[model samples]
Each structure stands twice: as C-alpha cells, then as structure tokens.
Target chain A: MAEIAWREALNQALAEEMERDANVFLMGEEVARYDGAYKVSQGLLAKFGSARVVDTPISELGFAGLGVGAALVGLRPVIEMMTWNFAVLAMDQIVHNAAKVRQMSGGQLRCPIVFRGPNGAGGRLAAQHSQSLEANYAHFPGLKVVAPSTPADAKGLLKASIRDDNPIVFLEAELLYGVKGEVPPGELLLPLGQASLKREGSDCTLITWSRMYYHAEEAARQLEAEGIHVDLLDLRTLKPLDEAAILTSVRKTNRAVIVEEGWSFCGVGAQLVDLIQSQAFDDLDAPVQRVTGLDVNRSYAAVLEHAAEVNPARIVAAVKQVLYREEG
Target chain B: MAPAYPKDLVLRFFRSMYLIRRFEERAAQAYGQGKINGFCHLYIGQEAVAVGVNEAVQPRDYLITAYRDHGYALARGADVGMVMAELFGRGTGYSKGKGGSMHIYDIEHNVLGGYGIVGGQIPLAAGTAFAARYRNDDRITVCYFGDAAANQGSFHETLNMAAKWSLPVIFLCENNRYGMGTAMTRVSAVAKVARRAVAYDMRAESVDGHDVLKVYETVKDCAAWCRSGKGPVLLEADTYRYRGHSMSDAATYRSKEEVEAERKSDPIPRLRAWAVSAQLATEAEFDALEAEVKATVDEAVKFADASPEPPVEELWTDHLVEPGERDVPPRERVRGVKVDWPRYPSGQELRVKWDLEPRIPVQDGEPHLKKPA
Candidate 1:
C-alpha cells in the first residue's frame, strides 16, 4: 500500500467509482475544465469525459435540486459544492427535498445522491469560507452526515456515501485534505456510523471527529506523558453518532471531553455531551468538559485566529481540567 | 397522419370526459358523506386536459402530476375501483393505502406518484426524462401542474435544467386560473403561464383546454418533438375548475357569473355538439353513452365500497424497506464490493456487538463465491 493525500484519495475513489458505474456523474462549478476548485476532482474530466464530469453554472440551488431529481430517476449524482459554506444557499433543496424525499413520498422515491466539498476551519479562510454546518445538517433525521479525517477514511467513506441508497452529506475537512495516510488498494467502502479509536487510554475519554481527531490524538499523547491516559474516538459519521461506541468509552473512563471545530453552543460537540450524560450518567465521575471554536467568525490575523478556535493545547487543558475534577 | 379523428376515437374521448365528470361528482358526494378523508382536489371542469393529453402520449411514456390528479390517473388507465379504494385508504389501492387522494402511483404504468407540495413534481419529471435518456428509451415524460406552480422556484430550475440537457419532457401547465383560494391575477403579474417558458428557451404554446381536439392535437405535436430528441416542450392547457379547489372550498375567489360562463363553454358539450353535427352520433346515442358512464361509475363505487379496508398489518408493509432490499444500489457498490464464499451468518439467531474501537478485519484468503459463467 502506498501513502496518498486525503484529497488525492478522494479523487481516486471518484475515478474508481466512475469507472465502475456508467450512471455515476459529477457536477459542480470548477469540477469539469478547472479540475476542481480544491483540485479533488483533478484528472477526472480527462478520464470520464464531459458527459460524466459536468461543469455547472453558479446556480447552487438549481443544480443541487436537479441532482436530487436526477437521483430519484436512477442516476447517482455526486454534487460538489465549492465549500460547505455555500451549501447554505441550497439548504432548502438539500433539507426539504433531497433528505425528506424518501420518507415524504411514503417510500415511493429514494434519493441516492451525495453532496461533498471542503468544510470546517481551513486556515484563515474567514467567515464565509470557513464554517462547519454539520450540527445544522445533523438536526434533520433522514440525512446521513459523514466527516472523514484520514486519507483512507476519506476514500472509503466517499465511496460508501456514493453507493448508499439514501442521500448523504459528505463533509470533507479542508485542513485534512492534504494530510497523507495508507489506503488499501483496489476497492474499499468504509461503513457509515462506525467510530474509530484513534488512540487508546484509560483515565479519560476524548470524543471528536474530522480535523479535531488529530488535535485529540495530540492532546492524548501529551496527557500520556503526564500520566493521564486518554482514549480518543473519531466519530467518522456524525448523524448516526455511533452511540454504542461513545457510551462504552465513557463507561470505561468515567470522564469525558468533547471537541469540535464549530462554536460550542448547539454544535455537534454539545450534542455529544448530552448523549454521554444521558447514557452514562452513573459512570461519569466528573462533569463533562468541551473544547470548541469560539462563537464569532475567525479573524484574519494569526494570533486572533489561534485564540478563536480550539487546538491541541486547549484540548489538553480541557482533559486536565476533567481529570483534576475527578481527583477532587 | 393529420387526418381528422375517426368517429370511434371521437366517441371514446367523449366517453372518457363524461366518466371523469360523473366520477368526480360522485367523489365529492362521498367526501360529503365522510367516506373520503384528507385533501380531495376535484377535476370537475378540467376533463379535456386529461383526455386530450393522455391521447397524445404512448402507454410506455412516463406521466407525473400535482395533487389535482384523479382525472390524470383515470386517463392513464388506473382501475377506477383501485383509485377509489386509494381515496378510501384501502388495501386494494394502488399504493396499498400508503398514498391517499393527493398521492397515487403506478410504477407498472410509469405513472409516478402525485405530489402534494405545489410544483414539487417538476424536477422529478425532469429526472424521469433523464433516466429514460440514460436507458436509451424513446419514452418521454408528460408532467402536469397548475399556473400557481409556474411561479415556483422548482418550475424555473427544472425548466432550465431540462433546456440545458435537452431532456425529453413536456411541462403541461393546466392554467386553471386559481391555486387553492387565490386567483392567478392576485399571485402573478403576468397571468399567462405559457409565456414564462421562453425563459428556458423551450418551445411553448397556449391552447384552449376546453377544446379536446385542440389539446389533443397540440400535445401530440409536442410529444412527437420530445420523442424525436428535440428536447422539452411546454403546453399550457388553459382550463378551469367548476368545483371549488377542494371539496371544502367555498370558491369566494371568483364570482358565480364567471363559473356559469365557463360552464357554457364546457368541453364535453362542445365536443358533443361537433360529434352530432358531423353525424358521429345521435342525441339518443349520446344519452346512452352518458347512461353507460353513470353505470360504470356506480359499479366502481360499489366495487370500492364492497372492497375490504386495508388490514392494520398491511399498513407497515410498504412503509419501510425489508432487510435485503436497498432502494437504488449504485453501480460501483454492486460491482466493486468483493465478497467471499458462504460466510453468510448461519441459522435463525443472529447476534451483533458494538465495539468502542474498530472491529477486527475478516481474512480475504478464503475462496470467493464465483458467479456462474
């Protein structure tokens, strides 16, 4: 197995899926001639030709709705939004139309569609470009939300999302796209709703996903030096939450800390904290702590940006705080 | 090919219209008697739109529509009793009582479910056309909606996509002048819905929906254009609904005089006049046809009334997918995901466990189940 960047892994998955399926097609603003805004769809236009790799107008709502419509009729369409922030423009179609089509049609129609692109805090992209809407999307029931951290997970989850019978929101972290990992060759499909144990420990449980999984691992290593063992859980699929895995981890450690890139209030991290409290209340030895991005948008300056969001240092502090409370 | 409709064909169209009118009237009565529940949109004054349009398309072509769908289903050859049972939420219904009056689907006939939300069926119809093209089928889609839906975002979006891709679909807008309690004049600045088709650069026209011959000929021409791969077309059937929007409608949106005026120009009587003038049928023959239609509707009602209500156990039958069934399996998933031989979970009992960590990988060294050559 050779190591490849997360973005390249995504590209390979698209190429493989397209080669295998005649009905699978791609559509987005820069997906065709320009390769892709993020270059994840690079080399696809040349390989699949124009019919499959379609370049759409800047009409997000129109094309997204059209993708849903096409999915209903039998075409498996992978729609790439330039960024997750832009998906808000088409939220009506994604939420009301695509997500609910199967249930509302009384099971008459099923949308085998995927909406994927860059998401979460990506460097200093600022307010409009850098935002995680996973919590907002996960609020809806019929939708499946997937956020992949590693290159292998990116390729496998994207392939699985495309193949799924239901509509899926595949949220790719912009910061993690260039990160590299070993991906099994040929074809692979990682199942949705299964969390991965990024690192094992005993003293406390650190639950996170996407780019934050890396931060959680870093914090866990630092705490291991301080004699505080931390178990890191990467929630590959946010919607399904992998409740069994999370509760099991919480039950084992009696202490929990949730981390997310979005603002803490009503964010996906907050939802996790609630789930832990409800499921493993008796097992918890200390109040659950959380490390999340600030409520305001990220500032352009490096200093302000660093203070605006959670990082490895903040995660370590939160874990330490939970452990100290457990001792007290 | 442009020859005048034969006597038999003309008589058949007349009979279909009469059947729809009588059936809808009976349905309204049933609703009044508390037999039918939920929303019931009648097609009392819109008979020609269904008859004329159905005559244009082939049996294999796809058909989709909005909530005003009783006439369209009847025109598409859905069993009258089955449709009535659907309205009554019975087991023998087309959707097994899952879909009511506003939503009826027949996959075998390619009649997609009627949508409740205004203008929702527009994009779905385009998708159906896309599928037809992908399969290399000559079948075209005929999507019917109202003038109100023409103002919806889906209408514009679907039209643009259909035009850009040259999908084989015909957007049939039955401009019945009202959407529920609101009049067209109140909602849209430009009352003519057909003119909006120019935005999509699709071929479009306004036809007198009251004239069955006109609607039939126009839809036939449009259907031909779509079948020939010339892309989508728009046919605005300018019709009117004699009854209120639904069974509960008071119809205060328009005056009684307007209703009377439209009734005077009713499609059935106009067609009957031509049939008689052309010596296609006598007054006695027309009366006999009307009597036959009433008897057919009466028989349908009896059949529906006698039909047993859907059993409670069957309510959940079509609600969810079974264990082995996936709605639409992506091509790659079916072909790419490899499997090994005979490792299927054995026996009646099955147990599953949740792991905090990723589960152990199954070995791939075993001989894979090979497909028979």
Candidate 2:
C-alpha cells in the first residue's frame, strides 16, 4: 500500500483504465494541456496524448452530450465536469439523454460513460458553486452514483465505475484532494453497491457517505473516547444502495444517525430516513436522527457556511441524541 | 459529379418515397382509429430528403436525427414490420415498444436514434463521427433535424468542433419554414439555416428539398466533401411538412392554399416524371409498384398487431450491465454490454438483416400518386 493524495489515486485510476482499454478516453474543460481543473488528470495529456485526453470548450451540455454519443457507439468516455455546480448547465444531457437512452432505446443503446468532478461545498464558494446535486442525479434511473471519501476507495470505485457498462456520476470533494490516504496498487476494483464498514461498534449506526464520512468518523472517535461505541458505515454507492448492509447495521445497532453535507429536505439523508423507517421499523430501538446541512442556500461567510455544513460537533450531538445521551 | 443513378436505384428511390407516403398515410389512419397515439410526426412532404440523403450515404456510414424519423429508419434499411411495430408500441418494435415513433432506433443500420428533444441530437451526430475518427474509420454521419434546432447552442458548438477537428459529419437541416406552430423567422433573425455555418467557417449549402434528383446530387457532393476529410458540411433542405406537427394539432397555423402551393413540386410525381422522361420506367409499372407498397405497409400493421407486449419483467432488465467477478471461469460471460455482446438485450442480433427489400420493378413504371394531385 502506498500513501498518496486523493488526486494521485484518481489520476492513477484514469491512467490504468486508459491503458487497459483502448476504447476508454477522457474529455473536459482544462483536462488536457491545463492538467485538469483540479490537477486530478495531471500527466494524462502527456502520457495518453491529445487524442485520448481532450480539452473541450466551455460548452458543458455540448460536450456532455457528445460523451453520451461516444458511449452510445461503444466508447468508454470519462467526462470531467469542472464541478458538480457547473454540471447544472449539462443536466439536460445528463437528466434526459444519459439516464433515458437505455430505457428509451429499449436496451438497444447502453451509456457506459462517467461524469466526474468535485461536488458540494468547495471552501465557501457560495450557493451556486457549492450545491450538492447528487440527489438529483440519484433520482434518475439508468445511472449509478458513487462518492468515495478516501483515496483507496476513490481509486477502486472510479475503476469500477469506468468499467461498468452504465452511466455513473462520480463525486469528489475539492477539500479532500490533498488529504492523504493509504491506497493499494493494481486492479483495485471494488464492485459498486457495496458499503464499507468504516468503523465497528454496537451502540449506534452512523450512516453517511462522501465528505460527510470524515465528520462522522471524527464524531465516532470523540464518542468512543467517552465510552460510547457506534458503527460508522460509509455508503459509497448511492443508487443501487447497499440495502443489505444498511439493514444489517441498523438491525444490529437498533439506532441510526445519518450525517450529510447537503440540504435535509429531499437529500440523500431524507431517502435514508424513509428506508430505515420502512425496512428496519421493528429493528430500531429509537427513531433515526439526521444531521444535515440546514435547509437553506449555502452561504459564503465562513461562520454561516460552518453552520450550514455537517461538522463533528453537530454529528456528535446527533449521535448522542440517537443514543439518548444528549438532550432529545 | 455523381454517375447516372442505375435504373434499379431510381426505382428503389421511388419505392422508398412511395412506401414512406403510404406508411405515413396508414399511420395517420391508425392514429385516428386510436391504434397508435403520442407524437406522430409524419414525413409526408419531406420524403425526398429522407430517401435521397439515405441513398447518398454508404451502408457502413451512420445517421441520426431529431423526431419525425420513421421515414429515415425505413430508408436506412430498418425492418418495416419492426418500424410499424415500434409505432404501435409493441414488443417487436425497433425499441421493443420502449421507443415510440419519435424515438425509433435502428442501430444495425447505424441509424443511432430519433431524439425527441429538438437540438439534443446535434452533439450526438458529431460524436458518432468523432468515435469513427478516433478509430481512423472513414465512416461519416448524417444528422437530420428541423430548422429551429440550428439555433440551439449544441448545434453551433457541434459545428465548431466538427469543423475544428475536421470530423466527417453532414448536418442535414430539413427547414420546413416553421418550428411546430411557430414560424422560424419569428425565432431567429437569420432564418436560412445553412448560412449560419459561415460563423463556424464550415461548408454549407441550401438545396431544393422538393426535387429528389437535386437532393440526391447535393447529398452526393456533400458526403464526398465530408468523406474527403474537409470537415463537416451543413446542408439545408428547403422543404415543408404537409401535416400538423403531431397527431394532436390540426395544423391551424397554415392555410390550405399555402399547403396546395407547396404540393405543385410534390417530389413523388416530380421524380416519377423525370424517371418517365429518362425512360427509367413507363407509366404502367408505377401503378403495380403502388399496390405492392400498400400491401407491404398493410402486412407491417398486421405484424405489429399480432406482436405481444414486452414481458413485465423487462422493466427491471438492462438497467445496468454488471461484469461478474474478477475473472471468468472458462471464457468471458455475456455481460450484456452492446460492445461485449454481439446480441441485443432482447436477444436480437446487433447486425440486423433487412428482410423487406422493395419489390418495385426496374422497368419503366406509372406515376399516379393518388393524393395531392
């Protein structure tokens, strides 16, 4: 295992996949000569050359639709959106074309493409740039959604996503690009829809994914030091959601607290709440508590943004409430 | 310069035009009887463009277009029985009843799809050529869309990219004057769709859409220009749709006189007259050809009517193609990926064989259109 930054892990995954399959190619704004908007694609242009690593103009919908076209004809295209926020411009292609092509063509056409980039709050970038839009994509069928919080998971999931014959939305956090993690080398493909057990405990289950996993992990540590142990499950795949793992954890713990760095209403947490209540109704010792970003537009100020985002303090408090340790 | 079209080829064009006209007429009748519903954009007056452009492209080349697509699919060699089934939303349809008339797809013929969204197909057209170019394949793409789609950002962006990369794709604009109920002049200041290619520095042309021979000649030249790797070419076919936008509208936006004025250049008769003048066919043969096409369309309807509905379990299938395990036991398992599996999810072969070749005789034939005379 090699300790590397999250960007390198993703870069390695892209390089390896491109080398493995001739059909695999990468395209997006600043992905070639500029080395990607986040440097996640650094050295790809030099290694693969311009034909594979394409630099597209600032037409999100145009290029995104083009990727879908390429995918339709049996090309595995990895489209890099500068950010999930900018992806809104290309949502027509994503929401309508990518998600509906398979079903629309009655399974004649398959969209085996990946649209990846940083998602959610990118350091006080405000409302437009910081919106967490995974739920919107997750709502669409014929799409697989993955967000890996660690470098190793990122490499594995990204490789699996690229290989899977389905359109996938891979979300990354700008803040976590520089975060270091130990990544295993070579063919590290983790099958999609499998949730990883981040931490093991019996008291309560902290269910979260993407960047929220870190905050939840920190909260779990603090609670552990105080003599309370909980199961922290990071659900990497959101669409073909790991219902088995979720049910197993909730059935074991009999209590749940979902942490997410996105708006509460209609967010990923909202769906989890419904799933837990419906499927694990008899298993719960207490009602599921959710700590999510406040239902409001993301603010630019640090303090307001801090209040809106899910942090260790809020997560700890939610866990305590679910465990009946803090004020309910 | 295109060589003289063979007698069989000219007869095939007439058969294609007649088949489309008859098919649309039957489809309209079906829609009225409530056998088929939803957006049924017929290609009645625009028959020449579909047949001529399709004839010009090689079988290995690709084609994509917006809605109003049954004609293009049929001309590109999609099974008429399946095409009719698709209109009826039956299990045997091209998309197995999943894609209605507006979304007919014949992947085997390289007719990518008929996109419902107006300008959505523009980028897809360019990308199909992009994929071919990536493999150094000489195959080009023919993208069909209405005049209004040209105003879309994707259209402009695609033109820029196709030109910049010198991609082999022909953007065929069927400028029927209006977009739905609204006139194209009201939406964009520059209504001539082909002229807009100047801004992108791409090859462009405006052609007589009503004349089948002219459209065929122009597409031949344009396709050659694209295949030679000059770049993408935008060809605007000056034509008009004889019917309403869909089955729903009564076509109240236009006048009966306006429709009549356009019918004088009716491609069916115009081409027949030329074919007769060229001694390609005599008047008597056209009558028998019309009967044969009508029977063909009738058989299609019966085939569609008898086809079963897709199994309910089909809803859950083909959503994703998950490769099993790290290694295959003996050989690779069929993962259902189109590229991996040579067969379609419905167990249909990827390369579909066209069963219903036009039976129109090569000898001189008659030219009685039976409508708009």
Candidate 3:
C-alpha cells in the first residue's frame, strides 16, 4: 500500500490503466503537453505519445462529439472535461449523443468511454466554476455516476470505471486532489454500487458521497466523542444507489442523515432520503434529516461560500436533529 | 470525365426514388392507422437528391444525413424492411427500434448514422474522412444536410477543417427551401447556400436537383476529386419537398400550387424521358423495373408487419458495449503521443486485467497487448 494524495492516486490509476490497455487514450485541453490543467495527466504525454495523449483545441463540443464518434467505431476514449462547468458546452454530445447512443441503438452499439474532471464547489472558484452536477448526470439512467472521496477509492474506482462497458461520469472534487490516503498496489477493480463503510456506529446512519463523504466522516468522528455512535456510509456510485447497503444501515441505526455538496431541491441527498423512507420506512426511529448546500449558486466570498455548502458542523447538527427527533 | 453508368443504373435510381415516395406515402397511412408514432419527416419531392448523390459513391464510402434521412438511407442501400421495422419499433429494425426514422446507423454498411440535430453530423463526417485518410484508406465520405444547416457553426468548422487537412469528403446540401416552418429566404440572408463553401477555400457547385443526371454528374466529379486527395467539395442541390415537413404538419407555410409547380420538373419523369428518347432503355424495361420495385416494396411492408417487436430483454441491449466483446483499445498512454499498452519489464510477460474478460499479455517494451477480450 502506498500513501499518496487523492489527485496523485487518480493520476496513478489513469497511468496504470493506460499502461494496461492500448485503446485507452486521453484527450482534453492542456491534458497532454501542459501536463493537464490539474496535473492529473502529468508524465502521460511523455510516456504515451501524441496519438494517444491528445491535446485538443478549446472546442469542447467538437472534441466531445469526436470522442463519441471514435468510441462508436471501437476506441475506448477517456475524455477529460476541463471542469464540470465547461462541460455544459458539450452537453449536447453527452446528453443527446454519448449517453443516449447505446439505448438509442437498442444496444447495437455501446459507448465504452469515461468523462472525468473536477466537479462540485471548491475554494473561491466563484459561481460559474463551482457547481455539483451529479444529480444533473444521475437524472439520466443510461449513464453511470461515480464520485469517490478517498485516494484509494479514487484510484480503484477510476480503474473500475475506465474498464466498465458503459459510459461513466467520474466526478472528482478539485479540493480533494491533495488529500492523501493509502492505495493498494497493483491492478485493482472496485465494483460499482457498493457503499464503503467509512465508520461504524449504532445510534444513526450518515449517508453521503464525493466531497460530502469526508464531511460525514469528520462529523461521525466528532459525534463519536459525544457518545453519539454515527454510522458513515460513502455512496461511491449514485445512480445504482447501493440500496441494500443503505437500507441495511438504516435498519440497524434506525436514524438517518443524508449529506450532499449540491443543492437541496431534487439533489442526490433528497434521492437518498426517499430511498431510506421507501425501503426502510418502519425501521426509522425518526424522520430522515438532510444536510445539503443552499439551492442558490455558490458565491465567491470565502465566508459565504463556506456557509453555502455542506460541512462537518452542519452534518453533525443534522445527525443530532435526526437522532433526537420525534415521529408524527 | 464521367464513368459510363449504363441505362440500368438510371432506371435503378428512378426505382429507388419511387420506392422512397411510396414508402413515405405508406408511412402516412400507417401513421393514420396509429402504427407509427413520433416525428415522421417525409421525403416526398426531394427523392431525386438522395438518389443522385447516393449513385455517385460506392458501398465502401461513408454516408450520413440530417433528420430528413429515410430517402438517404434507402438510397445508400439500407434494407427496406429494416427501415420499415424501425418505424414500427420492431426488434429487427435499424438501431433495434431505438431510433425511429432519424437515427438509422449500420456501421458495417458504412452508413455512420442519420443525425436528428441539423449540422451535427457535418464535423463527424469530416472526422470519419480524417480517420480514413489517417489510416491511408482511399474511400471518400458523403455528408448530407438541409440548406438550413449551412448556417450552423459545424458547417463552417467542418468545411474549414476538411480544406485545411484535405480530407476526402463531399458535403451535399439538399436545399428544399424550408427549414421546418421558416423558408430559406427568411433564415438565410444569402440565398445561394452553395456559395458559403467558398469561404473554406473548398470548391463549391450548385446543380439542378430536379434533374438526377445533373446531380449525378456534379457529385461524381467532386467525389472523384476528393478520392484523389484534392480535398472536400460542397454540392447544393436545389430541390423541393412535395409533402409537409412531417406527417403531422399542416404545411401552412407553403402553398399547394408551389409544391405542384416544383413537381412539374420532377427528376423521375425527366430521367425516364431521357432513358426512352435517347434509346438507352425500352418502355417495356422501364415498366418491368417499376414493377420489380413495387414488388420489393410490397415484400418490405409485409416483412415489417410480420417482424416481431424488439425483445423486452433487448431494451437495455446494444446501447452500451456488450460484455465479453472488447476490441476497442484501452484508453491510456504508451510512449509519447501514441497510446499503447504497458510493457512487462523486458523478458517477463506483463499480464494485465482490462475488465471481466481474461488477462491479456503485453510484450516487454511494448505499450499494447496481443488483443482485447
């Protein structure tokens, strides 16, 4: 096992996967010669050559559609969006073409590709750059969504995602890149739809994913000191939901708190709460509480931005509210 | 110089146009009977454009068109029954009934796909041509779109790219004069859509789309030029649609007399007259070919009626990669710009697991493996 930053783990996974598969090529702005906008593609161009490590023009729609067409003709292309924000320029390709091609073809063709980049709010990137689009992608069924919280999970999950037969939207937080953890060595393929238990507890179940999972874990650690045994579950894949794991945890703890870095309205957290209620309604000790960002766009002010999104304090408070609430 | 395409080819082109006309008429009937659903864009009067351009290319050449694409598909050699079944949402239909009339794609036949978005396939078609040239293939690609698509950004981008790279592609604009409800006059300030190609430094030509021979001669020359690596060309075939934009359309924008006036110069009768007046074919031969085409149409309708709907299990099928069939290379870097698989530390076999399939072996110092699963 090697301890490295989350960003390095992602880069390692990408490098390892590229080394493992010949068809696995990377393309994006500054992804090749410049070593990627985030350094995730560092040393890739030096190793892969230009044909595989393609540095494309700033036309996202053109390149995205080009990648989709290439994938249709038998090439596993790993497209790196500069960020989830700029991906909107290529939304037509992803939503109308890439995501729908397989289903639209009635399974005659499969887009075995991955679209990855930084997602959700981090630091003071301001309104346009900072936004969580997991729900936006998860709204579509044909796509598989993966948002990893830890370095090990990022690398393992990325390897699994890159190799998956379906089109995967891999959402990584920009702030989580430098965060480190121990990653198991060698070729590892983590299965999708499996929630990892970050921490075990008996009083309440805290369900979250991506950057929010860290907040949930931190809150769980803080709650443990206060004698509130909070269960922290990291939902790596959002679409598949890992309902069995979520329900099982909810059944045990009987109290649930869902956290997300996205807006509350129709957010991934809301979907989890719905799942908990429907799957384990009678098992709940109180109403399921949710910790999510404000529905408005993320502001640039440091204090306002910090308060706008889900954090450990909010998650802990939500857990406390859920654990102490009375049912109607 | 134009290749001496025999009388039989012209007759076949006529029959194809006739088949498209009849098939669409039958589709209108089916829509009335509630058999076909969704947006049904008919290619009534614009049949000649598809037949003429499709005739200029070989089966190995790539073909793509916009939403108004049934005639293009039939002209490019898509099976009639499959086209019909696609409309019926049957399992055997093109796209497995996933895409109705607009999105027919048969990669084996080299018909990339019929795009619903206008001008969306332009860049894709250029990319296909680029791939062919990169692979040193001599084949050319034909990208068909409406006159309205000329205003799209992809049109400018594709034309510029094709000219700069000298990719073998033919951009055929079937100017039926209307883009949905808006006439070309209302949308385009400059009426000569073909002239737009000159902006990319590529050759541009406009032909009488009402005359199949004119369309054929023009496209064949341009296609030849592209095949010789001279670069892409644009052909604007000024045609007209006899029917509304789609089945549900009232066609309130255009008058019936205008449609009838355009039909007076229809390519079918004009070609038949030449085939007879020039003694290229006998009246009997023309009759026989038309009858044969009618029989094929009858068989297609019956085949579509008899074909089963897509199997329920197939709903989630074909849309993604089928497990166990891995031919697309792994997306990774090998050495520099070229992406190859990892090499085992020399003299040792580097076995790597890609997905659910068996472990693949990579040579020492080699970036790729023996094969995908």
Residue range B48-115, candidate 1, lDDT tens digits:
99999888889888898889888998877767877787787765666655577888765545667678
DockQ scores of all models, one per candidate: 0.14, 0.42, 0.39
Judging by lDDT, tell me the better candidate of 1 and 3.
1
Q: Mind giving the per-residue lDDT tens digits that candidate 2 earns over A1-328?
A: 7899999999999999888776888999999989988999999988877768888888898889889888887778999999998899888888788888877777667888999999988887988988888899999888999988999999999999998888999999988999999998667999899999999999999998988899999999999988889999999989889988999999999999998888888998889989999999999988999998899998899999887888898988888887778543
User: Which DockQ value does candidate 1 get?
Assistant: 0.14
The residue ranges of model 3 lying beyond 4 angstroms of the native Cα positions read A325-328, B1-3, B126-140, B153-168, B198-205, B221-232, B311-322, B325-373
Which of the predicted structures, 1 or 3, would earn the higher DockQ when compared with the native?
3
- Which residue pairs in model 1 clash with each other? none
Report the C-alpha displacement of residue A296, candidate 2, in angstroms: 1.4
Compared with the true structure, all predictions reach lDDT values of 0.80, 0.84, 0.77
Q: Flag the better candidate by TM-score, 1 or 2.
A: 2
Which rank order by DockQ, best down to worst?
Answer: 2, 3, 1
* Lowest lDDT block of 10, candidate 3 chain B: B327-336
Count backbone clashes in candidate 2.
7
Off by over 4 Å in 1: A104-106, A123-126, A263-266, A295-308, A326-328, B1-3, B90-92, B282-323, B326-373
Taking the tens digit of each residue's C-alpha lDDT, what string does model 2 give over B276-307? 88888988888888899999999989988888
Q: State residue B48's C-alpha deviation in candidate 3, in Å.
A: 2.9
**Candidate 2 DockQ vs. native:** 0.42
